[model samples]
Target: MRILSFNIQNLRLRQGAGQPRLDGARDRDEIGEASALDPADRRLSAALLAEAKADLVLLQEVFDTDTLDWFNTRLLPAAGLPSYPHAHCPPGNDGRGLDLAVLSRQPVQLTSHANVTPSDLGLEAPQPGLPVFRRDCLMVETGGLTVFTCHFKAPYPDPDTAWPVRRAEADATRRIIERHIPAPSQGLWLIAGDLNEPFEPDAEPAIQPLLPPFSTDLMARLPEDERWTYFDSHSGRYGQPDALLASPALAARWPDAIPQVLRAGLAYEATRHRGAHLQGVGRHRPHASDHAGVLLDLPGI
Candidate 1:
């Protein structure tokens, strides 16, 4: 089975207008015309995702259930996908009122849902705040495989102060996943999503280890030349942030379950994401997301 993971930057593209329409006029649920509803951009992202030929999709930064419903109904159908029978989306504090979502062509068993909030996860940062403010995990079972979708906190400009905050959030996520699979023989477990941290292809850090006795980052198994899931629109240089991690047993069973990065949809034409002041409504520009999508192919059992 093929699976795709992406953070669609709330599916709001930057266009002739710098930002999206984040004014108070918009309600709790409104996604269209955030950039004039560029039919081409919307169709292209949806098509690129469908081109993966995936049976499952773990998506983040989607506006809401309504927006996801719209995509599944209109966008994906336009790309020749008449249906996505299974889906799960829990609202998040993306600030702009977006949330994390998942869509699948096959049946999905939502085993668990956890809001990794500061209080819920027992994160100890300081008096002011905890590690992650708005993050959640959607753990589901499908096709004899356990899947978890996460959208980690972004490593903003402040590395010394806020970077570790993001790292702490990731650490909390790691613990949550680990709690589910104490031993390696639990089952086919896979984690995928926009992990804002940079994975040093050569050396895996202890704080964020997703390999060996625990799990292996499927992306690292591919040739270096082909491992990139994101590009800095401002610099035009490519990198890898989105990823997939699974157990050794699962890796052995599906040796060909490679992590493929979809990069065709990472380009900014006219709009720039300078916040609500410079831009208008959204955070990143319209084309795709600040980050590209990463997919994994799990052949049928």
Candidate 2:
């Protein structure tokens, strides 16, 4: 089975001239523009989604069911792709309405962990009391597969505070997933999205919850230079924050299933992103999303 993950940078509506847009919008529920699909960045995003030929898609930064439906029914088809029959969009905790969403061609069941906070998980409050996941962990099931799509706390300009919080969130996510898999027959699972961390050999941040005995980052086999899924012009640093981390059982079953970053959709330089921004809406370049789409092919059992 082919699965793709993308944090489509707030796929909201086209904003009115005086309305709040994606960049400056404070309200998470803001439906900025009429449809971002008409823009170049969104078109590039749609094209990449089509290229993956995935059976299922886990999308981040979606506004809600209506926005996801607009993407699935309008954007995907406009990009010359078949519409996904089954889609699930349960709002997450993000204030920007940047919720986690899933689209599948096959039937699947969904459960939202949006209300699963630190207190519910019985974990100490990292900061008085914060939500366990930065965004909701969407548990998606189809056949013998269970996929948990998450968008961890973003490593913003600040690293010290964000690091610990991210770690705590990761630990919480891992614990939650583990609580469900009591036996092997429960089937294989994986977590995919813009998890805001790196898998670099010398990477300082600890992503232990999504590593080793917990799960394996399938992008490990790629060369270092090719590992990046995002390019930050301001920092001049390239990172692979988005990933398709899989269960040990699933990896063993589909050993050849390696995750791939679709770099073709991203610009090679930061200047291009700026140029796109200057050029106007619809010009993708560096601004589509600082992140790229990561796709993995899982062999059918």
Clashes of each: 12, 13
Q: Give the C-alpha miss distance for residue 230 in model 1, angstroms.
A: 0.8
Winner by TM-score = 2
For each candidate, the alpha-carbon lDDT, in order, equals: 0.63, 0.72
Clashes of 1: 12
Error of 1 at 115 (Å): 3.1
- Please report, as a residue range, the 10-residue window in candidate 1 with the lowest summed lDDT: 273-282
Judged by whole-model lDDT over C-alpha atoms, candidate 1 comes out at 0.63
Which ranges in model 2 have alpha carbons more than 4 Å from their true place? 14-38, 126-130, 183-187, 198-204, 268-287
- Model 2 residue 237 lDDT score: 71
Local accuracy of candidate 2 as per-residue lDDT tens digits, 139-171: 888878888888888766576667877787777
